[model samples]
Target: MGVGDVSKRILLGRKLRSAQLGETLLPKRIALPVFASDALSSVAYAPDEVFIMLSLAGASYYVWSWKIAIAVAIVMAAVIASYRQTVHAYPSGGGDYEVAQVNLGKTAGTTVASALLVDYILTVAVSISSAAQYAASAVGWLQGHEALFASAMVLLLTASNLRGIRESGSFFAWPTYAFMFAILGMCLFGFFQLVAGTLPDVESADLVISPAPEYEGAVTTLGLLFLLARAFSSGCAALTGVEAISNGVPAFKRPKSRNAATTLLLLGMIAITMMVSIIVLAKKMGLRYVDPREFDRMTYFDGAPLPEDYDQHAVIAQIARAVFLDFSPGFYFVVTVTGIILVLAANTAFNGFPVLGSILAKDGYAPRALGSRGDRLAYSNGILFLAGMAIVLIIAFDAEVTKLIQLYIVGVFISFNLSQLGMIKHWTRELTTERDPDRRGKIYRSRVINAVGLSFTSVVLVVVLITKFLAGAWITILAMLFFFAVMRAIKGHYDKVQLELAADEDDKVLPTRVHAVVLVSKIHKPTLRALAFAKASRPNVLEGIYVATDPVETNRLIDAWDERNLGVPLKVLHSPYRELVRPILQYVAEIRKSNPRGVVAVYIPEYVVGRWWEQLLHNQTALRLKGRLLFSPGVMVTSVPYQLRSSEIAREREEREDFRVRPGDLRRGQVDERRDPGRRG
Candidate 1:
């Protein structure tokens, strides 16, 4: 095997056969982590956001924490119930984009696709950036390099996911389950202590939170409502990954829709529990956290302003410390798992984005490359593209979770509202045709569920826009619009190309005559071989064409051709500007213009070398000439390859690679065969 094959094997494991795709289908246990980690991991930071926004109004506003949590939980439940209908109705994995496209027309479908694309990207950026922050908190040296760290983590996740979904799911399942167990365990233990009146206070309990200057005095009812709306908008980050399951229903094992719906229900319940528990615990423990950028708003117990350097631990971290104050391991364990899960959360995006991209590609709204899977049955191109986009975002925002989180849930909520609305329309239409009373009743129930979901999500999306538009949510809106425009443009371009390429009744008609031109640079072995090959083809008119870059060389080549008594005439095209490719392309076009019914064949000699750098030294002119000539009508471009000595090594390596044993071959009891069908004499 060549070095690239070896490296790829090490990085992505052995390629799976198409028949083995069934093995990559994920069961519920593994699918939860693969698809729900993002929603689950939000507990580590979403509550922190809630606390941050509430702190803008001082500790007096802390009473609203549980209220916001409950509101978010209710919306999440509605969204989940709505999507449960989506999975059963449209289980082909297009999710919201499919429903919207099929029921609401192409424009709405494209809008949903663009929103989901942007949201998936933000999911990766937010999740990785949050993980970097947690890492910086755990290790002091990691403070200023979070962007680099986050970018590297994205690359790692991309590689892991390229190994296929089930493998990655299994690999990630343990950490996700561990996180769930640790957080739920801590919450249960903390609640038990609370019931017994023995819960401990957090480290920040003594620190007093003062409202920002705007909220210091008595505020109007509208101002108070806006403040609560802002807090709730921030808390809605918890719902960011709920639609991932709906988008990924096809990835589930047997009874795909049922399994996916069950997973969605489990994901919503767990996310709601964790989020609410964290918020309640934060309020109970008097956890004080505000945007560090708003340092003047926080104060010590003695009325002194907090120092600019005060590093506020996350809300979950504070609760973990306070709840397990006596046991150092418990605190460390919780913090460690929280950070790991935050990083793993991006895996959900890695899984969702590629599938959605593939669907878009299949629908002709994206580049066709995204529709092809890698050797491992994973959408490798889409995975790598998502990682690259996430890296750009991480670097652009400097991996600050708070800043990245501001642009977080807007796209998600947009998708949610549109999807729910689409589902409502879908069921309404179905109910009209579903005559069985029992089935009609189910459809009616589904329509009502989706209608409620739409109502709630529409309100939240408005609140998110109002609360976050000026605070960076506009960037996400702009990005979604940009993607929408680009996809539409791509679709337009593809449609034009398809129309231009359509075959007609005369497409199979033969050309009247064939004229072959062998491109010649000098009187060398490659040129002679090209001349000989052209002669063997026996075209009606065969000629050796040369561009006269230098008069002396051109004359010498003519003299050499005469001396060899070559039967084919040599035609030299003079170039005053010393150009090679343009003159050849222009010459071919002239030939076609002279005899429009004839086909012109341009054979260019190209040297094939083994090493990559060697390639740069050769084929420069031949490749350019071929590229230009291929665009001319009635012309065909061909490359006659001349293999160099180093190319032998490459050939041997490829030969060996062809016989390499793939995964499952041994298990299937297949014999290793090194026999080559094209063995050279």
Candidate 2:
């Protein structure tokens, strides 16, 4: 094997045969964490966001935090129920894009795809950065290096996911479950302590929060309502990943829809329970939190300014500390699991985005390479693309969760509302075509569920837009628009190319004749092979053409050609400027000028080398010549490869071995057949 092949094997492991795809299917146990981590992990920071927004109006507004959580929970439940209907109806896993395309139009489908893509990218960035913040809080050495740490986490997640969804899912499942237990355990313990009248106040309970300059003194009723609305909207970040399950139903094992719906229900329940519990605990423990940017407004109980380097813990962090006080192990455990789960939340996007991207690519709205599986049966390109974009955002935003979270939920809610709207339309259209009364009643019930989902998500979407548009959500809107335009352009390019390349009755009419030219440089095996192959094609006219840069070498080639008694005629063109490419290109253009109706077939010999360095040593002229010929109308370029000794050794090794399927290959069902009989020579 060559160095390139050896290196690829080292990076990706053994190549997998296509037949083992069944092994990659994910069961509910693994799929839950794989697809639900994003939504579930939101409990770590979503409440923190609510607290931060409410802090804009001072501590008094904190009283409404749990109310905001309740509103978000209701919307989340509605969305989850709605998506359960979606998975059952559209199990092909196109998710929102497929629903919109089939029920709505292509434009609507592309719009949803654009929104979902942007949302997926932000999901990774926001989730990883949030995890990095939690890590920084736990480790003093990681304080200012959060961006670098977050980027490293993203890279690690990307590599793990490149192994394929099922493998990565299994790897991430335990930590996700651990997080679920930690948060739920903390909430239960904290609630029990409150019932026993033994819960202690948080460390920051004595701190006083002064409102922002604009909100100093008592606020007007209208102003307070708007402030509460903004805080509620920010809390809705918890709902960002709820739609991912619907988008990824096809990734589940047999009875994909049922498993996905169950997963979604579990995700909603856990997220809601955890979010509300955190909010209630934060309120009961008197946790004082604020945006670090507004630290100047906060004061200590002794009427002194707080420490200049004071680092406020998150809402969950404070709750964990208050509940686990005197038990250092439980405190560390809760914090560690929360941080780890937040990072793994990006895995949910890692699973959903590539699947949706592959569907788009297969439909010609994305690059075709995304539709092709990689060595490990993963959508490697899509996975890497998402990781790279997330890393960029993490670095650009300096891994500040508050800043990244501002750009998070808007895109997701946009997708949710549009998808629900499309689902309602989907069921309506289906009902029109059905004649059975029982089936129609079921369809009507499904529509009603979707309608409720649409109403709830639409309200949240508007609230998010109205409240957060100026608070970094506009950036996400611009990003979604940019993606929409780019996808549309890609679709347009694919359509244009398809139209131009489609074979028709006109294409069947052959050229009046074929004029073949052999590109000759030296009297060697490569030249001989090209000449033999061109002669076998049996064109009406044939000639050996050479660009003469050196007269002595040119004369030597001519003498050798004549000495061999070669029947093919030779045509030599002289170039004083030593321009090899221009001379050959000029000759081909002249031939086309003479016979506009005939095809000029250029025969170029190419060396097939085993080693990478060997490729650099040969084929410079042949490569450039073929590139120039392709730009010329009515011209064809053919490569007649002449294998080297090293190539033969490499080929022999490949022939002796059979390919085996690696991890994740079973899910994609990709097959590699033996070489065709016609290609053996």
Which candidate number maximizes TM-score?
A: 2
lDDT of 1 at 368: 93
Candidate 1, residues 1-681, lDDT tens digits: the string is 657788998999987778888989998989999999999999988898888888888888899999999999999999899989999999999998999899889998999999999999999999999999999988999989999999999988988999999888999999999999999999999999899999999988888877888888887899889999999999999998888998898899989999999999999989999889988988888788889687776678899877767888888888999999899899989999999999999999988999999999998999999989999999999999999999999999999988998899998888888888888888888877878999988888889999999999999999999999999999999999999999999999999999999999988998999999998888788888888888888889999898998989989999999999888898999999998888888888888999999999888888989988899999988877777766788898878889999899999888776676666666764434435444523
Q: Could you tell me every candidate's TM-score relative to the true structure?
A: 0.95, 0.96
Please list the C-alpha lDDT of all candidates, in the order they appear. 0.90, 0.87
Best by lDDT: 1
lDDT of 2 by residue, 1-681 (tens): 567777877766665546556667899999899988999988888888888888888988898988898898898889888999999999998888888888779888888999999999999999999889888878999999999999999999988888778789988999999988999999999999999999999988999998898788899998898888888888888888887888788778989999998988888888899999989999999988888788887898777998888888887778888899989788888899899998999999998899889999999889988888887888888998899999999999999887887788888887787788899888888887999999999999999999999899888888889888898999999999998999999999999999999998998888988999998888899999899999999999999999899989999999999999779999999999999899888888998999998999999888998777888999998888888788899999999999999898878877654344446545544223333334422
For model 1, the superposed segments whose C-alpha errors exceed 4 Å read 506-509, 522-529, 532-538, 549-560, 563-566, 574-578, 662-664, 672-681
